[model samples]
Target chain A: GAGVSQTPSNKVTEKGKYVELRCDPISGHTALYWYRQSLGQGPEFLIYFQGTGAADDSGLPNDRFFAVRPEGSVSTLKIQRTERGDSAVYLCASSLIGTSGQETQYFGPGTRLLVL
Target chain B: AQSVTQLDSQVPVFEEAPVELRCNYSSSVSVYLFWYVQYPNQGLQLLLKYLSGSTLVKSINGFEAEFNKSQTSFHLRKPSVHISDTAEYFCAVKSRVGGKLQFGAGTQVVVTP
Candidate 1:
């Protein structure tokens, strides 16, 4: 009955530092996704995982941005050399099955990352 | 590739008044349409979606969205709104089955008494 949850509701870090954002999907969910939302902009896709393997990761901005989902239940988004441009709200979502695009994605409260 | 555009950035309406939020999408392939709502300090919630069959879809609440293929638009409307309806609404599209979503800039609805 629990929904997707993210850790560290807010994070503040300096440029060139590293940060990790965690996401715990709903129980029994087989698919997970990450997105980023900048001020005055809509959420942009980042990465997706189907089970323990990443099904789609084309949305990842660069090699500095990586994500891992071990055991197919929890996911972590890691950012290396954080930049002010990476400052945004990191969102996580999950669905029962990702085979159909019709599945509704349940979102988390998101983690607000600020780079100073 | 797919793209979505929300016509208005903000809409202010009086309580119990009609309200409409316009959304348009562009894609080379057929896509699934969806509307998501986000209340302050809350996560994004699904309002409604248009996958197939019916061109129109309604949410549990008093919200409805009509999908138009010709116009490539999925506009959400509500005949009457409550102050509780104040929130941000987003229009999104998925070009492929189980693929990533393309979201439009959200529309902030401010309901006033």
Candidate 2:
């Protein structure tokens, strides 16, 4: 793809439900990231992947939030036992791996999740 | 650990007026700084970055930012802003090696006619 792509631009789920959000990074980009943005706030890092492995997951918030990139190209973010507080936009970004400086991160349109 | 702070949550300015958005960060190691803009219903777009060299950096869109190492600040400024420039701006920082970004809360700029 020419740019990072996220599926299901919006999602609405009831409390305690499970939801999955998908992201497809640009081709040949080995670094992928996930972020969550609440109303009136900046995007908060959730996870980062280098190739098929998770380089960092410390920012996942809790056990209910999980993400995986099995092939290093497509990633999925799963939230279990969703709470109303989980309502936010989930963003995905990709960058070329091993870029010494702060490489530009190409972001997707983002998935707006509304936990009712 | 790294964190970014955007002092203003919202800023209002008339079209063609000068505007400045303040950002600061705290980090133990040397860091790279960036500013991103998000228009309505659009993904984030990079505005400018400060990796090394001169303290000042300019974007193609008439926006500029100065990185002050002593104060740990990277403030964005525009001499003349357009109504089309109204959007949400975010300040982010990351370790030179680690690609993960830590972002400020964000500042919403509203350009009134």
Candidate 3:
């Protein structure tokens, strides 16, 4: 009955620092996704995971951004050398099915990251 | 590449008035369309989606969207809205069956009583 959950609702870090955002998907969900949303803008795709491996990571902006879902249930988005432009809300989503794309994605509360 | 466009950046309306949010998308391949709503300081929630079959799709909360391939648009409409309906609405498109979704800028609906 629990929905997707994220940790550290808000995070503030200095530029050039690193941060990790965690996401816990709903039980029995195999597909997980991460998105970034700037102020007053819609969310943009970041990465996707189907089980243990990333099905498609083309959405990732650069090599500094990476994600891991070792157990296939929880995922962590890693940002290296954070910049002011990286300041945004990081959202996580999960669905019962993923490969088919028909399943509806359930979103998390999101973690607001601020780089100063 | 797939992209979405929300025609209106903001839509203000009085309570009990009809409202419509326009959306258009561009993609070389067939795509799935969806509308999501986000309340202040909250995450996005599914409002409605157009996958296949009937072109018209409705949500449980008095919201509906129609898929138009010719126009490459999927507009959201609510005949009569309540003040509580104020929020940001987004139009998104998925080019592949299980691929990344491209989202529009979003429309902020401000409902006045």
TM-score of chain B of each: 0.97, 0.99, 0.97
Estimated TM-score for each candidate: 0.98, 0.97, 0.97
TM-score of chain B as predicted in candidate 2:
0.99
Candidate with top TM-score is 1
Q: Kindly give the stretch of ten consecutive residues in candidate 1 chain B with the minimal lDDT sum.
A: B93-102
Indicate whether candidate 2 or candidate 3 has the larger DockQ: 2
Top lDDT model: 2
Residues B15-104 of candidate 2 have per-residue lDDT tens digits of 999999999999999999999999988999889999999999999999999999999999999999999999999999989878789999
Instruction: Supply every candidate's count of residue pairs whose N, Cα or C atoms clash at under 3 angstroms.
Output: 0, 0, 0
> Where does model 2 sit among the CAPRI classes?
high
Please provide, for model 2 over A1-116, each residue's C-alpha lDDT reduced to its tens digit, 9 standing for 90 to 100: 48999999999999999999999999999999999999988999999999999999988999999998997799999999999999999999999887685578989999999999
lDDT of each residue in B1-113, candidate 3, tens digit only: 88899999999999999999999999988898999999887889999988899999999999999999999999999999998899999999987566677899999999999
Best by DockQ: 2
Q: Write the per-residue lDDT of candidate 1 for residues A51-112, one digit (tens) a residue.
A: 99998998999999999998899999999999999999999999877556677789999999
Instruction: Classify candidate 1 by CAPRI docking class.
Output: medium
